[model samples]
Target: MEFVPEEGKHLHEDCSTLILPALSIGNVGQLVADLLISSMGSERVGYLDDPNVLPCVGNDAYGPFPQGDLALPLEAYDSPSNALTIIQQRSPVVKGMMIEFAKNMADFLAGSGKKHIVVLSSLDFGKWQKVDMSSGLQIYYLSSSNSNGTDENCEQLGWKKLQEYDPSQMHWKYLSDLAEGNVTVEDITSVEDELEEENYYASLPFAALFSFLKAKGLKVTCLLCYCSEGDNISDAFQLGDAVCKLLQLSHPTTGIEGGKWRVPLSWMSVYGPPPDVSIF
Candidate 1:
């Protein structure tokens, strides 16, 4: 849960907003993070040193060629001009260690003087019940600053507030209790073992992160969409666009496809090497 800055590189002092991806359906959040980092040309500032996350390493995800830069399980990038600090997660937390991870992250960000957090994630489209077709690709949001209603800006942006977030409900209350340090993981496990009700939000990593960050008195907003597992690059672009609009970040005009965004070179083989042309 400690932050290890790269040699001669440190967290941006002016960056107050932290954009993070909650490893969820389609890994849309991570993809959006990739888009933001690549397009913005953000610099890697530091990485999280925590044992709770499963270890992972791979080629640098942004470069056009193999630069020998290793991508770790959790790394932080800073965009000073945009006043943003984005965290890119390439691995999931260890089983039963989510709460501890969330707590540590909340503490770390709070101590780091972060003022706002924007969490990007996705929902299972099969589980989503679309009620309004007119809205078109509904983006649902849950914010600590606007729990009772939608934020005016978000409303203007055509994003809907998550309606299922009732803290009074038993399943949701359990998470709040846990985030506030009033309940332990064992207590929750025992309670959940007795309950037969299945709660979707309670099971996602975003829920824990949101609750913990909110408990730390930081503004947290979760932007979510509904999509199933498949090629979700388009979903990532849409979410990335929404985030840019939400944060008022100026889109760099040097990217591909009319310069709206710069697609990472690592994405060239996203689906894996043209199906081995020799086999065709």
Candidate 2:
């Protein structure tokens, strides 16, 4: 991975937090990162160029005005006021290269001296039937073994750990059900075990990232929101608010209470009204 820093600007060596998002279900994590980049007035400090990442180009998502200027697929930002460095990943890693991408990211963080890494992500509710989706939304956390204060921080913020599933038990139940329907015991035993030993309840990038971080003993924390696949603006807003609370970026006196998370102007054209259509 190659980092191209902005001309005449460099990342703060002492930046404490590294905030990023894994491209997950509903795109909630990316949206939350967008809100942070806009709300915190973060600047593009650099761009990461890696062969493992898919190529993408688009207008800046947090621009003050629609200038039609193009942006890189992966850009990095810094919020000095918050003492945080943010990574805005607009695309997913190329297929089969997730492991390589995670390794490069781990190397970058290890060399950057950042103390904490926070990943905003989402998980599919359908895979885990136990997830309570009646409340419309819920945020959970999973921290690496080396997480210094992330566990305490989540507790102080009242966030819960994502429910874990026992793959062995689940697999056994499935095998038993198949056996009752004329399936032979030998056939069931012959089936390769598809269950993972540790299920973080996350999709590809987030799960791969967590594995890499844990193996390297890096202090990484993942904040996940349970969501369905649809117009998930509400999910993104809730996730943004959760991160805001965790980072103490909101003010009680600013009228930025519940359900009032800030939205960037770039989202106005997200669905596109077509080039011929203009709003007066």
Candidate 3:
């Protein structure tokens, strides 16, 4: 009830898009947003949780909302860099706060026409164990990071673009771009500590988000691409890689395939009809 649709607008008609893994988890979604010409649904106005806890201390923040509880939002992205971040916002985790925020988002979504809530996230080998705290289920990851949704990278990679960017806008990016398996990682050590563990990892933001979206009667799905977490548990390479594919971009070839892209003529044919067709 706190959500106000635009005048002349129906609550069920507005499409709110979410870019995932904003802090520690949203690297992939950020890339897709930039290339696809999409943006964060609405840069948050207030945050349910406190900042200065961990990773989000430097990257994400939440302030007072003159509007309402629904307005207390978690706004990510401070730099001129535009990757649609779904950052975890912290290291020690704050799933409860994020869940509260998601609850508010879901309530808003409940009365709206959000066709689909596409969540972007990747599995951190460590959190993977916690989110599932499992009895032995192996998770496999495939990173389509280099496959471009379209040929947008040709424009994104130009030196001219990077030069004009504001440094503050892209703080998480430099690290995310760094290949996966670069961060120290560990697996879930206890099931009883699931809540405590996840709070510490806070990597389950995507799943919680999906659940919140569903609670609001929204259709939701999570998309992922594996990161090269070979040794590093927090590496977002796969997420980053998958994002590139979603947006159809290429990394400047450092003779690397994970981050670099090479879209083929055949790939372009996947979308349009037989090269020549104007349907009435």
Candidate 4:
């Protein structure tokens, strides 16, 4: 993997944080990265180009308005004022290359003098069944072995770590038995047991990143949400808000009635009004 800077540009800076997304359920991480880049008005800093990764090209998602103009697939951005840098992957990495990519990314970040790394991700909601939708959304953090300061800050802010579960444990067996019996929804105790089991069984991409960071003794933290597969725009918004609070990024209050979070201009046509169809 190679990072190619834009013409006449230098990436070295006193960057305090490096933010990126891990491709996971609901694409929540990618959406959060998009929100950060657009809301912060970050500029194109560079890009990661590698043959092992899938190639992608599309119009700038954060453009002033949605258009067909083109941009790189994996681009980097920086907000000097906030002392933050962002790496947004518009597409997923090719299969079998995640470990290599993660290692390269860790090396790049470690050499950048950045103090923190934040990865936004999501987990499968079906694995657990006790979602308290009325209590507002919940987000959890996982700090790297070297991130004591980050862990303390999260604790001070009252953020909880995600409850882990071992897939091979009795809890999972019980859940499986229940499922076989057509009992999709179990008792609260069973659900709690399922959700609270302590284990790390993240997807390959996330695991790769964590492994690389741990091997290099780098400080990193991950903010994650429980999500199901589908149109998860709401999940994305909630996670975005959590990240904003954690980083103190400028953000408005939640709720569409109150004021919705700013979505990228490129999403305007995501569902399509058809290029020929007009509301005018």
Most accurate candidate by TM-score: 1
* lDDT over C-alpha atoms for residue 132 of model 3: 32
TM-score of 4: 0.76
Task: State residue 147's C-alpha deviation in candidate 3, in Å.
Answer: 30
TM-score of 2: 0.78
The per-residue C-alpha lDDT of model 3 at residue 200 equals 36
Clashing pairs in 1: none
Tens digits of per-residue lDDT, candidate 4, 1-280, equal 6788888875648567888788888888988888777776577778888665688888767767656656777778887766788888877887756655776777777777777788888888876556766667777777764322137777776677655533345444333333234343334344543444542344336655754655566677888888888777888888888877788865423312234555788778766675565645
Q: Model 2: residues >4 Å from true position, as ranges?
A: 133-136, 145-150, 165-203, 251-261, 274-280
After superposition, candidate 1 runs with Cα above 4 Å error: 131-135, 193-197, 253-258, 275-280
What local lDDT score does residue 261 receive in model 3, on the 0 to 100 scale? 33
Question: TM-score of every model?
Answer: 0.93, 0.78, 0.37, 0.76
Instruction: Estimate, for each residue in 1-280, the C-alpha lDDT of model 3 and write its tens digit.
Output: 2533333432222224334443333343434433222222223322324332233333112221122222122333211133232322224335435444555555654554445455654444443332332322222221112221112332343211112112122221211221122321122123324534434322245544554554455555455433333322223334444444444434433223453332222223324556445653
Q: Give the local distance difference test score of model 2.
A: 0.70
- Candidate 3 vs candidate 4, lDDT winner: 4
lDDT of each: 0.86, 0.70, 0.35, 0.68
lDDT of 1 at 94: 96
Per-residue lDDT tens digits for candidate 2, residues 1-280, read: 7888899888877568888899988888888888777777677888999898889898757666767756788888888777889888888898756656877887777777778788888887776656566765777887764233147778777777755522135443333233233343355444333433323342257755665555555677888887778777888878887877777775333224353545677788777665564653
Q: Candidate 2: lDDT of 205?
A: 78
